[model samples]
Target: MNDLGFTDEEIERYARHITLPQVGGIGQRKLINSKVLVIGAGGLGSPLLLYLAAAGVGTIGIIDDDKVELSNLQRQIIHTNDNIKIHKTDSAKKAILDINPNVNVITYKERFSFKNAEDIVSKFDIVADGSDNFGTRFLANDVCYLKNKTLVSAAILRFEGQISSYSAHKGSNCCYRCLWPEPPPKGLIASCGEAGVFGALAGSIGSIQAIEVLKEILGIGHSLNNYLVIFDTLSSEMRKVKINKDNNCKLCGSKPTITSITNHKDYR
Candidate 1:
């Protein structure tokens, strides 16, 4: 058994994790006591959820109102054809528990919005945004800033993807709003369903997102703090660009303005 009450099976299963110098017995315990909330159960969420659970994150909360569809299986590796029509959260929970029953899976079968975002996010230590829409992404960022929680955000489209982390603890780092003060005009953005993302693109970015979360929880390694890491799957190239916290950022600005989590009308 591990330091955090992991069973013999868990020890064997997570042996790879425990053996790492950066993540030894102490890190394993941290993971066992850590609580991470994932904001979606689709594409990006699939790999993030599976790896986090398999790594033995003590408590995992999945917030998604979507159901598994046959088409989703093409990129969403967690769900299966047999799970079509099943709630995405339910399907993810089953898959995670099947891999490691030690994990505690919490499901929010409703969409995350300004109304419930605070409450849902407050219950976990770290928040990972795998939601596809801008509204939910902004809501998650605002809630994370308000709760002073570490937020690991990632987005995948076509052959490109980006990942970053925002936290007050990281010393004046930028939040999602700092990068995109406003969502792209509607029709300017297209979902994977329409634009078509390479299957491995989401996997690559999502897995990096999971690593960011693990590093945050274990308090180890350099994270994508105050910078955005962009991956181009087609060219097999990656770039990191520095990002500064806007002095007038709505969320984390010096003059600080946005006091409430109000829905941005433009998102609709």
Candidate 2:
């Protein structure tokens, strides 16, 4: 164990990262000290949590009110058949600890909503949004923006996925609301359950989300802020589109209308 307090086991475990010029012992230590909050424990959260734990992220917080369902096994690899019917937060915490017992796992057996957003998000350095609904996505972006937390958010539906990081608090970067002013009309966009997501697609996108989160913690590589990445498995193509902050955007615009996070009255 050196002055950094890395046990011999930890040194060996993160040798690959410590050897990298971009992420030597310093970067590994940064990962060890950083805290991240994940907004779901389902498909995207499954791989995202696992990878974050394996990469030696010291503190992880998981929030999800739902229980593991049999259908979740198709993409939510963090849970086994034994975990079915268990709260997703509980199941994901178990999986994270199993991968890296040194990690501090905080489980919130509740949804990430306006009532709890500020209190919960304020505790973490970064947030990863893997939620499946537009409401949750929008709420997370808003709360993270208002709180000045970096948000790494991703979504998967059918064979397509989209991901971006938002740090609108920086003033120059665009928030999710900049790209999407509002949630689409009801019945306009189908849910993953309704549309049938490709199970492997979750792995692909979730892995990338994990990468972006790690990069943010280590302050390495290009940030996805002000940009959105769209992956199409069917076409085997990936597109990185620049997202400019909209002056008319209600949330992050010049004249911001949404100065606070509210329950989705408009979303309804």
Candidate 3:
């Protein structure tokens, strides 16, 4: 129950968005009533939370089990120096509330797993995957497919990033599993902690993820349905490769076989 629903204050607050042909008063109202769930409140989650809150997404759920450490400050912009040691979900809730009191923040200070993924993701109109690991990504994708929820996903490593959207509701499109049929062997991939990622690089990709979520919610723009946009900040290269839905894709293919989230041995 928002008192300022479409008021001059709201119009002024989102004047830029309202002016756009794609998003008028109706679309602004849609945004005010939309619910988005964001997984992980770390580097990629930083900008996604900020921009989505500032854009007036009605309800935003943030899930993260980790606490803010001094090491995370270099990239996790949502947590302040004074907020160190606090749970990331708590820190993100405060930041979102500060950006726009109109947004309702739900904080889950726990990791997203197969057990809780469906329940949490089912509550939102869309889910943004900012997770740093492949296990969580696969889990989120499968859960979203089951729940028929739009999944706006992004991943960043070093100076490169990739963003895409997946939903059976939108019809045939490759899902996370379609891209990587199986998780890389253990120790095959290095995390930002080990490989190190540019702080701004995560921001760039996370912001794009937020935009994709907004577009899906507002039903505006050509959603990234079957394409993956890859960005290389160092070389200043941006590429959008069309992704064909795999006929044998275990997740979203025509004769799909993956019906549940199974703990893959390699993911461990």
Candidate 4:
């Protein structure tokens, strides 16, 4: 084993990470000890999962109810044409294992629902949201906020994408709901399916999400908490804007109206 209890194989696999001053043997150990959950196995989830696995994150939990589709190959690089009919969770688990045998992957072939969110989110040290829908995204944020887990959230559409980390439990840091009190009107927003997204754009945002997850695990550098990163690949513009927590935020605020997953008591 290496000085940090890493096996000789692990040390060799993560040689670069172990040599970095910010993420030396100590940080590498933290990563191995970390259990991270990734929501969705398409688009943003693809690159994030691959990178996390390659980074040697020991335990990874992936939840995805859908099956891979021919269209998904455009951006979901974790899966190949052979996995078109397979469940996303299964496809992702296979890819992750192929990249890093040391990683223990847990595959859940189901969507993230209130019934399962708590049990799943509670087990992981950190959560990453790569889901495409507002419902799933909001659910993840609320659950993470309530469970006091750090959340790395991101979304992509057309040539633009946004990313942010939330840990309202840390105080001053904003939860996803803190910035978006509620989901936008259904018709007002167009999903990747409806509006179409640039495949590589998803990679950009998902990579950022993966970087944030690693930072949270290593506790290095300034986090994305309370900062919203917006990227417009079309214009090649990137902006980092501050997000202030809403005092009346239903989930993470001075007085939270969302305490339980079920029955969602809206005190507002």
The prediction achieving the highest TM-score against the true structure is: 2
> What tens-digit string does per-residue lDDT give for candidate 4 at 1-268?
3556877788889999988999989898999999999999999999999999999899999999999999999999999999999999988999998889899999899878888999999999999999888888888888887898999999999899999999988968788887888888777889789999999998889999999999999999999999999999989999999989888887777788788887342211
lDDT of each: 0.88, 0.93, 0.87, 0.90
Model 2 C-alpha lDDT per residue in residues 1-268, reported as the tens digit of each score: 2878899999999999999999998899999999999999999999999999999999999999999999999999999999899999998998888889999999999988888989999999999999999889989988898899999999999999999999999968889998888889888999988999999999999999999999999999999999999999999999999989888888888899999877765433
Best by lDDT, which number?
2
**lDDT of candidate 2 at residue 149, scale 0 to 100:** 97
Model 3, range 179-237, lDDT digits (tens) per residue? 77878876788988899999999889999999999999898879998889999998999
Error of 3 at 265 (Å): 4.3
The window of 10 residues in a row where model 3 has the poorest summed lDDT is 259-268
Query: What are the C-alpha RMSDs, in order, of all predicted structures?
Result: 1.5, 1.1, 2.1, 2.0
TM-score of each: 0.95, 0.97, 0.95, 0.97
Better of 1 and 2 by TM-score: 2
lDDT of 4: 0.90
Per TM-score, what order, best first?
2, 4, 1, 3
TM-score of 1: 0.95
Q: Which residue segments of model 1 deviate by more than 4 Å?
A: 1-6
Candidate 1 weakest lDDT stretch, 10 residues? 259-268
Better of 1 and 4 by lDDT: 4
The residue pairs found clashing in candidate 2 are none
Enumerate clash totals for all models, in the order shown: 0, 0, 0, 0
Q: Model 2, stretches more than 4 Å misplaced? A: 266-268
